[model samples]
Target: MKNKFIKISVCTLALSLLLGSCTDDILDEQSRTVYTPDYFKTEAGVIGGLTGMYAHLRYMYGQAYYYNATLTGTDEATWGQSADGNFKDADLSGVGNLNSSSSRSDVLWNTAFSNINAANGIIENASAVGISEALVSEARFFRAFDYFLLVQTFGGVPLDLGSGELKFNVSQNRTSVRNTVPEVYTKVIFPDLVTAVANLPDAGRVTGGATKTVARLHLAKAYLTYGWWLENPNNIPTYPETPRTDPDGHNAQWYFQKAYDIAIEGIDNPGPFALQPTFYDVNVATNDRNNEILLMADHTESSEIFNGGSLTFGSGGAPDNFAGWMLTWNYTSLVSGTTPAWTAKVSSVQREAAQPYGRPWVRMAPPQGVFNNTFADKVNDSRYDGTFTTVYRGNWDKTTLIGTNPVLYGANGIAVEPGDAIFSFLNEEPSQPIDFSNTTYNSGIGAGVLPGRADFVLPPSRISRRVYPGLWKLGPYRTDNAGGLGQPNAGSTRPFNVAKFSELYLVAAEAAVKGAATQPGKSARDLVNVLRARAGKWRYSNADNAVFIQDNSAAAVAATPAVIDINYILAERSREYFGEGYRWFDLVRTQKWNELAGTYTICGPNLTDVTPQTFTRTIQPFHYLRPIPQGQLDAMDMPDADIEAYQNPGYE
Candidate 1:
């Protein structure tokens, strides 16, 4: 809050100058010239105005470290990393922090709002100056997008609809708590998106590209999120997370249909926006700015500068130095404990698999006794490869198992075990299973090992043989995949920080499945297969494909597809977007948030076993709205907001 002017608030200052006729005064001097409202009257200005909104977002997301820590890691979820207590202490109380806007801690907060302000400014002034009519829609859509981030992250926030209000109400007591999810959908989210759909020009709506289609995508998302949030009193979607029960749940169907309607309308025809169908070049280190990335903020330049570290990751200054789970743990790339070296010791979760070496720090694993078989056996799961890659030829061959091979190596690789002095606190390991030709136990004599046992019992050292064992190399991080597994030790970029478009696809796919779109098949079952096939999963089509719609309902999803099932769709959302921080909000929308509500633990294997999941909130039916900061809450009182309660009002 100290340097509120640091990039974010500077947005307000810049915008104010635009609305008033005093813009010429700001440009009074030629050398110290400032681009005023009149300046943006040109094509460059129009582009720059849009660019300004986009610039705020580019500085916002995508560091494997941040993705892991905040989204999937202990920062938000109860992934195993919280087991020992290293990060996100409040969320993972013992290890996380509040005032430490350290990395992207508040990036989502400031950037989203700033972008929103800029967007509003663009919309407010673009029309007055006669900027392209198309640009106005794009601006409005983007402004809505910024609002989406705010609503999703902090729940209901003050609605700053236009550039007219000249009030400095940044103080807490100046606003209200939690806007109705419906109100948000009807007003801010829907209007802008609809305007986007009509006014967003024909800007070559490429795959990763933004255009009317992108507007449609978010609108669909807004509908789905809104319905799901209000599905139940607690915000726990009507759907259940386990084995997919009651897939239909509430008015999810109605919303899903609307989502689909918009998606189809945006395209007008199928041929154009069809997926590019090219395989993901997993080798592309970063800068995955291809058309594949739909609706993303432009971070192409930042994405390409890949290395051992980023502003999103690190500890005590050495930069690249990190904790392991950053790659595989938190997000649904894999469950921890399943892969040996990538155990709770490596991540904090027990069931998630550990990435070979594409390490971030907050590796994802599951609870102590929970086996991630649901996720592990998804060999053909689309998210699998997107999350972690397959490295070896055969399955785990138990007999020749050493504790060093990557998770992909057959036998001869590291054997799995439970956490303890022998394993990790998360408990449990790979069955160290053997490929069978009548129960074969070897990696055929020349095989490898698992998480490498050198540090099997150590206090989590970085270079432990067991820690960086052959298990890592066998992963998508096979830095030498192009070298055909022969060359083992080159520090590779692609081999680090595993990422896949699968996550977003699933988001889109489910959006479709839930009636959010008009893909060829209206059911999620087919989409599931599409994803599974992409992950190289075995023939995903099941006997139930015919009855998928019927089998999938609010009460049950037994391989049927007679009708769309939102809960089942969500189950996939969970499986596909796990650890990606999808659950945090998914819980809210589906109204199943109570599953993660109340007291929870961050449990870690390195430090204390349990840490509380305390966070700032507004009130019941308003819990999703985060509390206003105490200082701001106190300063702005009476006439507007409830200053007294707004000041860190959680205790009451």
Candidate 2:
């Protein structure tokens, strides 16, 4: 609960700051005055230093780079536009574009090290300055968290545990060697997290800070990830110990048990962690900072400096626009209904007012197949409807047009209102023919068609390109500046939750199924059923009941309890965590990347003979770990041959 201030240089290895009070009055102004080691001995100074260490996290989680690395190349979503060479190459073609030189890859590497160095500064100096052991624990948690992500993304990263080595090696010689994945986990991540659990308080964890429970949750996750790695050691060819080919000696079950124990500790630990009653509570802006959120990439909505910029903190702070771009549609480019054509159209106030809709960026989209294939109970599952907005209302003033057109039905048979549903059934096949003769249906334009429109109606094919059921989970939902500056210029920002309590249940269920944990009377099926039951209840709730009108009620309910497996947990994760990030990592950690992503399709049954399935893509085994950034390899002070040796296998 300390609100200490620190002025940090994001690019550097040191976190230098003049300690400031927790109150905003003291932190409102910026100062460059530096404090001595004696200053850090005080509680405020240590907290201020901890603040600097936490600030670097925005670089990793609060941007498109991380999402691109994690979300693309997976089964859930695909690149929407063909022009983005990065997405096309890394995600679709599964080719060589994602090598070390990639700007995104380079930033991830730099950011991870920069934070790790800052954490090291705090940890090493904490003792010299006579700071609390709690500060050391917090610093270690961050060090472990950064190293965890680095190892997962790019295999072994350079391991530096102190400012002196980081500054001497990283800043000067670039001499730090890339540690192997297993070594980094065992040597750095695990120990730091264990210490973090020991020193931190039981609760009151914030977005940027960790609590004992938070540390435990991550420790569990770390165990789970490492367990998977042990089970599939070929993925970590650089692991120091003898690989587990026989799946016996300290196999995945061993770590899975550890993960299960820690996760159960967090569950039984008295804390504000629990699943939200309704699926909607987890995402809506009104519910920001709710108990369900374990950690979030916190953003400032009021301050323009926090306005989204592409990894450049100078534009303001590191407020990310992940929500503005991902899972959103460019409403401004919608095809005009009057033209009956698939051309770009501007947005209106009516369209702009919608809280969950945004101007089209069209960076990522899921194929109709994602819904049809993943959600076995698509209709009854509240997560499907809760996450996606299947309707877009027309902004054009069509009062006169509606008065003249008797067949244009609104809800029942009422006149078309400004915000009435203008688009629906977006999950339907693109080539499916529209029945304009059905006067009751408002398929944009049905019978009594307005002038200047064709009699036979065709659903806007460009919706797939521009507005395919915009994701509702990621939103500040702007009413202004629909498409002014694009990617990072989100006119308004929304807080992005990175981890939720819902995942703990899935983790427990997975560990249970893997025979790593005991549930006594309950099975893995029972744990999953708890989530399914919540989703099903939401489906039948008064507000959402009508949304499932198209579903076969009995069939949808029947699908929930019949079966539960790893695939079911994965599919449920896809439904629950769409575009919130972590899909690619989820697949890779579970060793399902190649199998699931190699055979992904976007259009599915919607593909007509002429359509050619535009979004089919595949993944290769080498994609299990991202290629070590070529920039890092080049920047290494070592011989060219040595750097090449350090590059991840198959990338060179």
Model 1, 399-496: lDDT tens per residue? 23322433431122344332211222111234563122312222211112334331122111121111211212122232223322221122222222
**Candidate 2 off by > 4 Å:** 1-9, 14-45, 94-96, 161-171, 205-208, 233-249, 305-318, 335-354, 395-415, 426-467, 477-492, 539-563, 603-618
Leading candidate by TM-score: 2
In the range 1-652, model 2's lDDT, one tens digit per residue, is 4322222434433222111222211122333233334445556655665655555555566466566667766777766652275555556554336665553555566666655665666665677667767768887888888788877777766665233433312233454456556667777888899999889875543453577877887898898888887777345344223444322346678888988888777877837577777676677666767777776555554444333332222232243545345556554433233222322222221334234455455667666556667654545677776777665555455333223322233322333444455445433344434444534333332212332332222233323433366776675543233533222344335556767777777787777766775756346676666667667645232222243333243444456555566677787788788777778878878877766776554432221321325444545566566776665565556777787777776677
Please give the CA lDDT of all the candidate structures.
0.38, 0.57
Residue 308's lDDT within candidate 1 is: 22
Q: What lDDT is reached at residue 580 by model 2?
A: 74
Q: Count the backbone clashes (under 3 Å) in each candidate.
A: 112, 7
Whole-structure CA lDDT of model 2: 0.57
TM-score, every prediction:
0.59, 0.80
User: Best candidate, lDDT-wise?
Assistant: 2
